[model samples]
Target: MNIDDMESLDEETRKEIEELRRITPEKHGNAFFAQAQFNLGATFIKNGNIEEALEAFSNIQHLHSPKLYAAAQYHIGEIIESNGDIESALSIWRNINHSDNPEIYAAAQSYIGFVLFEKNDIEEALLVWGNITHADAPEQYVQAQFNIGICLSEKLNKEEALLAWSNITRLDDPELYAQAQYNIGSNLLERKHVEGALLSWHNIEKKDNSEAYAKAQLRIGNTLTEQGDYQGGLLAWCNVERLDDLEAYAKAQFKIASFLISFEYKQAAIKELQLIELMDDAEAYAKAQFNIGILLGKNSDIKGAVKAFRNIKYEYDSSAYGNAQYRIARILISNNDLTDYTSAKTCFELAREVFSYEARSYIRILELLEVPETKSFGLSLLDLLNIVLDIVDILTLNFSKYADEEKPFERKLAHYTSTYTSNLLLGNDKNNTRPSSFRLNTINNVNDPSEGQLLIRKLKDVKDNSFVPLAFDKKFHAFISCFTFNHDSLNQFRLYGKQDNKEASGMSLVFKKDFFQSKNLIGGISYLSIDNTLKITEAISNINVKESHDIQGQKIKNENDDQELVRRSVMRCVYLDPTSDYFHLAQRNRLTFFREFGDNIVIKNGTKQSQAEYEWGVYQEYIKIITEKFEVAYQILKTTYKEVETEINNVRFTLGSLKQKELAILVDEILLPLKYLIKHSAFREEQECRMIYITSIDRPEVTMEYGSFLYVEYEPSVKDHLDKIYIAPAALQHKRYFDNILKNVDVPVEVSGNVFR
Candidate 1:
């Protein structure tokens, strides 16, 4: 039968072997009989008939040939060992009478050492192999020498181990030569002679496709890589020619891919990694998949990269598996079209949990972590409002001092009545009433006199129709209020108030010549000095806030005897109550009050007439406030304040300037009730964005449409990466409206001292 046909037909091959065995001459010391019997034993073992093979080898004692019997004993030992009977096989090999056959005796001795080495008796194994004299059996002698070196290396006797391996001069068999050279290289590496090791590894000629040759080639690449010659190492790994060891071949390919990736040959590296699946090594294949993902990602094939990483399977705490998960997250993030930010969030979370802190993925994930913003570039509308509200709170707290010290509207009305009655009874002017109301106006110049004139005209109309007290005149109020803090309040105020209440009654207006330059009023007292008194009042108010627990306390504290009564009196006059008639009067006359002063006070050096020469000075201090400062604040109210209001209820604000629609938007959609928000949220820029994060959820919209759910927007953007993009001030429409309203607006001031009532 043909060899191929015989290999496929095992029964026929066994029958032929049995026939040969039966027909062999039974004469003792007959070479043909011994050869036929040995062949039969080998065929039986090949057929997996270990019992028959063992019986055949044991019958070799009748051959009457020491060499054949010894060989047969060695075969019996191999069969027994193959059957996992290690001790029995060891005993059989040890008892083999190979004294007359040097080759067989040497092989038997080497087998004893091999079994001992496997059993972890390294010292005895070394002694057994070392006892073999290399006088005959070159094959066995070479093997014994190699084994001795391995044992010595295991014993850590580097010098003696190298000497033992180097003793092999004959190199007829390529496997033996490669094995010896490979051992020498290992010992050299152990001794730290990397270059010598490389040289020894390079000389391991693979004349046959042996495992040793494959290992030597792999080691050469490893040594070169250790020496920082990655390019050369990769080339050596690529040159690995081995069919006997698939694992080693896969490892070599993986190394080559890694090296190519280091050099940025991503496409080539990906191809090399892709070939690892052919090796069928689960661990190597997983590692290769991870590396291929990295390569594909580096090449900008994001989808391909994600697929590659997702393919890695569970393996014993596999670093590659963890790494693959991490890469998948990176691929998703880098895609940057996060239609659904939460979709990839789990991937990121899983990657972080799977990888250890020391893993490259873990470190990268940390670097990508979004830290909550403490500050921002531009304030959102709501954020700006919060700041304005905070400023208002501070100002209100300061104004509260006047509220406590000054007479209330009812008391002031009685005092004026008594004075009027006394004067009338004493035959004084019957129509005369002590200054019933007082005006505290902040004078600022307009850019165009016509603009100021326009404002004055508009103010008359507003004053006539409006009923709400204490018109804010955000433009002028911000300008003058800023000075109280030693800060330009105009630039800080973005709020606008508009009120209409017919029942509101009290109104007062007073004007004096040269108020801006002289800083002195009709009473020959310096307004500057009076302004100082107001500043002191504001300072005292701020100090009171810090010292007191409640800003708006129900019970008022009595003034100290040593306190400056005059300063308190003056500050009380400056207090424009939001609900009082005086406040209404001021709002009505606000535009006219502002027009009284020019935008700049031009003081020429040669001018000696101080009063007439000095005009309005440029109000650069508060110019920023009116132009666009409050735009963001307005937008905050306009956009999301209503939605915020429903979730919170601690603090409530009464905004004056907003229209009915704007007010509805605030209550219905934008503003949050203060209960759920931080107390000083308005003062904090971060709170603006934080609110968006809280309320602006991108829930996937589903509707009954055919079978699939329909979404209005696919893949909403992530909030973290988008913070900078949302940074914007109030809307342009609001600013334009304010500009138009302020340009021609005028406030009316009344200089009347008597009350008709």
Candidate 2:
């Protein structure tokens, strides 16, 4: 039978081998015996019996086919390499001298250069590829030239790189040629030849069907964006969406979303980011979720931010996964109103999987891990992680490259109230009306009728006035206390005494600004900043967040202070200006609060990290063996006139990333209560920063006032908090009375008698 017919039947090849053995050497001769042995080896290889295959290949005598004898050695090298013994593999390839099989000789050289290049021995790799020519192994020769181009580029020989890359033809290797075009375009772009770069990148898609085509489009979009042609850039990016390359598609989408954000279309940007969710790429999805979380956090939508971060899968990208973990932990710790140490500890532990902290962090963790089991012998450093993991944090790891210590500066805030209220505040022996401490009133009951009920009014208009009953019908109002961050503004004295035209000249109660931050109430202060006072909310806005991400821990001890942190989510600085773009978003958020987020909280399964690809397990060894069998078979047949092909479809495997989605569930639940922070733009002039505490209506902390309005007694850290008292400018006559009232106070007393006027 013909070898072509025999090639398809391994069983026939085995039968032929047995028949050849039965016949004498003189009957069929060395030709038929050698052919049968070679066919048996290929059969053994296909069956994944490497030992038997190697034995059969060894039976091929050099007297019959020297190329086949040489090809067998090449097969052994592949086996060695697949087993991770690259040294032996390289040695075997180096000795494969076969002038009879020029294709195999050049193909082996191609692999040798590839291994060298991957190991970063660029010069030697280039030297090996330089020996290849178009006459020998035509396809391998083109691939060799591709590697030479990379080598030349790495050595800064831009001119030589272009010349080497120019040698690749679209017909010979379109993928490599497309890559060359990308490199050439990049080089031209760097040289300021904008037209040349565009022309070069434009031809990539004409001949390329691989990821290189999408990459070229991505580059084109970047170039257009850089040249100030935003519409052209956006159009180019939009074209990359359906290019069958998820990573490049993700890059383009991110740019488009960034453009939307820069143009003050944040909601549109959010919708664009959400588009990444429909793609099948895990890394791209993780990246999109991370950015959305950050944007949400910046917008003071803490719930949405947490949900976005939790959506990242650990299996996608280690850095992104680590960042997601660290960010979640930071959010939990910063949101200390709930005092969720247990949850924070779990998040910190997950973050530890990807982040490697400095010596100081390990030392800090070690210091805290002082249990007897953890305090063992000299091998403590190795076992330290095992112990420290039980109690996570002090991992003040920010969004930056490394965790850093915080820097703090002290300051004070002045709260002006009626002299009678101040007298009652200081717990002086007043009438029966004096509370145990200062009172934070419910929003509806606040004196400012126009500004105080702004949030409730806005909510009543959204979803066709739907959320009002769900939020307010149950009397679930947020209690509030307003504070202005002015150090010593003259207008404060003028503004406070005449609230609603009430002639109530009050003394300013100066308290240490750290009092609120210490309690982690997050009062209009960025959760990112745990230490800084309210001096530069406007200035800090200009400073790069990475540079100013220093926070010192000053946790409030319950027994050490009478004040307690109630149910608070976030404290955003009052956004000023009615015409500002952010004000529009804030306004929209209030109106659509009920519509975007339904009456009940939602926990999405989609928010958890995506699963990871599984290891090539059962067929790991077989995959290597069978793949090498084909390599050897190709080499032995390269010099022959006949051609044969073999193929085996690969199976895919996966393992999913796992973590708690409590953070995602909390996002919808928290947004409703935190909605009270935004107010009507009319209150822009007051520049008031209010703290919103969403407590249940039945809590005993609610104190009834005037037999109708409700107030909560919040004993803020007031003992050392009173910095100084300034009697209102109009109340100069009562300055002596204020002094007598604050006689026990060690702070300075001043008269604000028409100082500005």
Which candidate ranks first by lDDT, i.e. highest?
2
Tens-digit lDDT track of model 2 for 1-757: 2334444447766576566446433576766666666666676678576666677767766676667656766676777788899988999788777474567778778878878876888788888888788888778887787777666765667788778878888888777777777777876775568888888778887447556667667778888865677798888778775455676777677778877976778888888878875364666677678779878988989889989988887787544665676677667645645335456556666655333231213333333234342222212332323222211111111111111111111134456677666656665434434434666676665444343333333322322212222234234456776664443445666667433344435566666553454322112212211111221111100100000000011111223224223222213233323233233111111212232224544323445321110111212332344334433432332212111101000000111112113212221222233245455555554445554454556656567667677777654535335777777665667777656645644666776534642
Candidate 1, after superposition: displacement of residue 717 in Å? 50
Compute each candidate's TM-score over C-alphas: 0.40, 0.40
lDDT value, residue 687 of candidate 2: 44
Model 1, CA-based lDDT: 0.43
Whole-model Cα lDDT per candidate? 0.43, 0.53
lDDT tens digits, residues 1-757, model 1? 3334445446778578757666445553366677677777787777666676677677666345678788898888887788799999889888766475778778888888878877889888888888677775777777777777766665667788788778765354466666667767866775567888888778766664356666777788877875667678777787765474576677787777766765678888888878877345667777777667767777777777778877886562244555566556544444565322343455545544332211222232233233222111011322423443432222111111111122111111001111122122222122342321111212222111221122222212232322223332221121111111101011111121111221112111111111111111111111122111111111100111000001111112322323422221111111212222221100011222133333534335664433212321222222233223333433343343333333222122322323323433333221221211211212221111001001111222212245532212112111101101100022222333223322322212222222221
Candidate 1 lDDT trough over 10 residues, lowest sum: 540-549
Clashes of 1: 57
676, model 2: CA deviation in Å? 39
